[model samples]
Target: MPAVTVEDLTVLPRLARPGLGDQPRPVWQVTNAPSGYEGEGFPVRRAFAGIDLSHLDPFIMMDQMGEVNYAPGEPKGTPWHPHRGFETVTYIIDGTFDHQDSHGGGGTITNGDTQWMTAGAGILHIEAPPEWLVQKGGLFHGIQLWVNLPRDAKLEAPRYQDLRSGTVALATTYDAGALVRVIAGSVDGHQGPGSTHTPMALVHATVEPGARLELPWEVEYNALGYVLNGSGTVGADDRPVRTGQATLFGPGDYLTYAADPVQDGRAVTLDVIIVGGRPIREPIAWAGPFVMNTKDEVLTAYEDYQRGRFGHIPV
Candidate 1:
């Protein structure tokens, strides 16, 4: 839960209150994420499950990796995999992960750090816990989001961005009741460090009990809010949402979410990840690991990958 925090939120730049002309985004739907295993059998919550692809345009899917405290020798991670036609954003909230790809893009990211990998054209990559972490397991929690690239940029060269926690932009509610960490894109003039082929914004916010967070958003981008922990109400109408839930919003100029006045001891505040992106609105042909614009393109990706066109895993 300690993705990033400020001892005194009041010291941070405050978000501007919604203007008179600002329109609040309406909550279109709320659905609970179903729990499952991923990678080498680590627990995960499929945050985008049951959500419509149209609403998630410009974005593919999201996985909430364990908020679990693993015992020694219980840690796990994903095996090598291939991806194309999109970007993978892995944000570590409370643990460490090692990332390496065949394209010479790799690093170790820990609490509050982010690894933005653009799998343009194609690439092979792997993610795993550090050896020490695997030996002496500790708390691990994070999010991995798949962002779709525009059709024109789908075959461009691959790129990677190692965005450190200190590089993230931070802000607070006007009343200093909530903390907002901008990981990518801009929020109320606070901009994140991660760059993307898509126009988007990614934010992690922690709202104190009874606190309300109102954020100005891009009118052109669609919006979604996923609760990482605790309970809250989304939208102006106060639609209830809780941990492991995702909220979809209709077109609007701003977004609103309020944490309940009471919370359990385990989670003293409500933690949420908010993301928005301009729609690509292109056809998507997805297979096990490849995401492409057509079935033929997907098949070609598989063929190219098998033929070692994506490059070899580092020795």
Candidate 2:
């Protein structure tokens, strides 16, 4: 686990979306203003595609979205949808979402709130627009991440944790002018909220221009960085990376980053969800929004949702 310089890092090609029926469009590499949700009014833009990291080992996908304004009294999000075999984390950076699920979980995720939902066996849920955000006409932005459950926990009982911003801890490494907020794991001797059933670590980071930060890597896991704003170079081997992109690191024990000194007025801020576990290496039978090891399991999940197996959640 020797430390490598940034110069040796290789830049991998960005992943593209798979073909859809008849025709399909190319996928984007960086986070952009999301188009309105398909059929629904919420905005959604994918941050990663084709499943990064180990298959159902640690994390599966990441989607970042924003809504600056919504029509008055208009619905703002996806209708009830089903999910199984994974955990969903919705972190609200701004605005609010009135969320409800079939398992008797319902609440509003306000600014700086986090909703961790484990759709272990099965769950149908919907996230709707909050009246305040719709009325005030302000900016709303956040991210949704999907973490895969371990094989043993795939069929476990579902649960939810609504965490306030004050409950999470933040640590700033002054040397690099970097702020690391612990959302799921330990960072700089500080721990985050909500215990994860699987071994996972997530941190939201911000770096000032010309600053350099070093991240210690863990063995037995894959690591990647998602740039949210500004631009910089990230990698153990001095690879040149920029904002609106994800840098997948190769096998290494540590990573180093340096903000572009030339961009003196600009800074780089990003969320790094470092996740990995013993790789499942099993077949991935994914359709629509559900991912399972076998196609039969996926079909069963859809059937269960349609049959009202996931009954209405109480407010």
Candidate 3:
């Protein structure tokens, strides 16, 4: 991965269409899925990494954790690790995700659960399947997105927001063709539970065939739409997209998306995530696991971790 700085993508351009009121927000660009690689123990397809994009401001990286069926004892998850200057947002769709962090934060998330952790100053954590799930062998799938923190507040006290399944804000369309779960920010007046340092919206949308959703978004925020399952179209332009794809949109206060239900009365379900946030637009000095504003700060962070400055994980 190459080192990406604010200079590299500050001027992100968008493809314009007839209008936001009628046209599907123009699909500026479609992402190319990179091959899957096992990180330490977790099998993942890195959807996007800040280091690979022209604009990686509020977000640094996103991973689609294994959606594969794991036989008993087949899944090896990430062990204890340290982080600083960023937040990790994990959403579980199937099976269970168990985690233990040095901060004494321990929990298990099942279907529809989301855990948001801000490793401000620093923290040590482990993420793996629950022992029972690992033994039983079943479906394991989830998403983990790295949300970046502003430089000035990089060293603030760490915090965690654990939202159990069905606890996060949710909205269903009038036609019942679409369902949206809010992880952060608001949708159709429904608000999420996570307290964020930046102004943003992270939502998971599932749309049945022929169903539609229009989100009132701010034109100033950088917006991204990622397809998780099935096929769907976005904006007034009706730009189509399939699974394993993401679309970056230009300035628009509203975004519309729908699934193309074309089967024999069986709705072709479309699952996608839409996220928008104000870009920090500052220099990014990124090192493995640690993201700071400068190289000197990154080096200092490594030194602090080596010296046990962030505190210790209970054995």
Tens-digit per-residue lDDT, 180-216, candidate 2: 5567765435667967886666666655577665654
Question: What RMSD does model 2 have?
Answer: 10.5
lDDT of 2: 0.62
Clashes of 1: 0
lDDT (Cα, tens digit) per residue for candidate 3, span 1-315: 000112222132221222435433455777855647555566676776423444656888788886678898887678678999999999887778788887778898878888999999998888888888878898877788888899878999888888876567766655555666777886546778877888888888777777776766666677788777777677778887777677777776677787886623222478787887888888888898898999999999999999998878887
Q: Sort by TM-score, best first.
A: 1, 3, 2
**Structural similarity to truth (TM-score) of each candidate:** 0.98, 0.79, 0.87
Using lDDT as the measure, name the better of candidate 2 and candidate 3: 3
User: Which candidate should be chosen as best, given lDDT against the real structure?
Assistant: 1
Tell me the alpha-carbon RMSD of every candidate.
0.9, 10.5, 8.6
TM-score of 1: 0.98
When summed lDDT is taken over every stretch of 10 residues in candidate 3, the lowest stretch is 1-10
**Count of clashes, each model:** 0, 7, 7
As for lDDT, the candidate ahead, 1 or 3, is 1
